[model samples]
Target: MKKIYLLFISCLAAFILNLILMNSAADMPVFFTSYLNDLLCMPIVLSICLFLIKSFSRKKSIRISLFSAFSLAALYSVYFEIYLPKVNTRYTADFTDVLLYFSGSLIFWLTHKFDSPKNIQKTT
Candidate 1:
């Protein structure tokens, strides 16, 4: 429940921040601002997906989920680097952007790995 709440809040903030960046005088999408958009959205989206995936099977501990989530994020970041630009002209492949994505993932992984329910027994 807490995870879901946090994901919603963060994703909403990211979207709002993206909107804010776009509507500013720059008059361009945030994504066009040198990975500013990726830096904002990657963690929210990836962490949510990773949380969802981890929730599917409760057999794994928080550490495993953390590693898996970050690993998946890294793999997907690499995937985007190799495939996204090819799929669309609006995007160009960039490893540095992927680095930002991985950083976000790692942060979330650590947060959840240490504090997730897997580490606690619900009293209720």
Candidate 2:
């Protein structure tokens, strides 16, 4: 579907931009380079997968997507911030990364409003 394609492209663009920022100027804030990517990765990837699978009620899709994103963020936070640090000294626990992950999910939920069924014009 067109919507799925669009979402995919958008996610791809974000990923590319993230990579660019990561390798670009060292002056870039940590939030803009690493934290921002962590925050955005879940929502974008999850949304792409959901949209590709099938269509559901708009509200239901939104709810499920948000839940999935949050779950992933939690898992990621616990792994990277808690578990990984215990095993690897290189991995430092950072609460700010967790916060950024949540922020990213929240942003996805907010921006997703534009993609709601009520907002999309159905082709006849």
Candidate 3:
């Protein structure tokens, strides 16, 4: 239950933040626009969610988490690509957005290597 709640909250936070970025006109910091945003937040959120689930429950594969991360990110892109542009007129879909989404998911997977608490402990 806690895992579910955590995942829900984290993903919700990411989704809402993404939406705000999509809608806002204020100038974002350079890092936020310079392709590092994918590495910073979304991946961290997903990886932490994966880490939390592994910490809480049965040891399962990460395949499901990766798939879910990719799916959710892609779905978010597609939805906004279609709707936001139609509704807001200010939002436009760029191929770079798709690239960023994929990069975010990939980074999320890459961070999974460090997701295990067992690895965080000193073995010797």
Worst 10 residues of 2 by lDDT: 56-65
* Best candidate, TM-score: 2
Candidate 1 stretches with Cα past 4 Å from truth are 1-8, 27-32, 50-64, 116-124
Give a tens-digit lDDT track for model 1, residues 6-47. 754776686787767767857674455566656655557755
All models: lDDT?
0.62, 0.66, 0.59
Angstrom error of the Cα, residue 119, model 3: value is 9.3
| lDDT tens readout by residue for model 3, 6-103 | 44456557656765785684777755554454434456556566557658756454333456777767776777666688889778766677677777
Q: Show how many residue pairs clash in every candidate, following the order shown.
A: 0, 0, 0
**How far off is residue 103 in model 2, in Å?**
1.4
Question: TM-score order of candidates, best first?
Answer: 2, 1, 3
Which has the better lDDT: candidate 2, or candidate 3?
2
Please give me the total number of clashing residue pairs in predicted model 1. 0
For each candidate, C-alpha RMSD in Å? 5.3, 5.8, 8.1
Model 2: per-residue Cα lDDT over 54-112, one tens digit each:
46444334333556667777888899889999999988898988997777666665555
Q: Look at candidate 2 and give me any clashing residue pairs.
A: none
Runs of candidate 2 exceeding 4 Å displacement = 1-8, 55-65, 119-124
lDDT of 1 at 13: 83
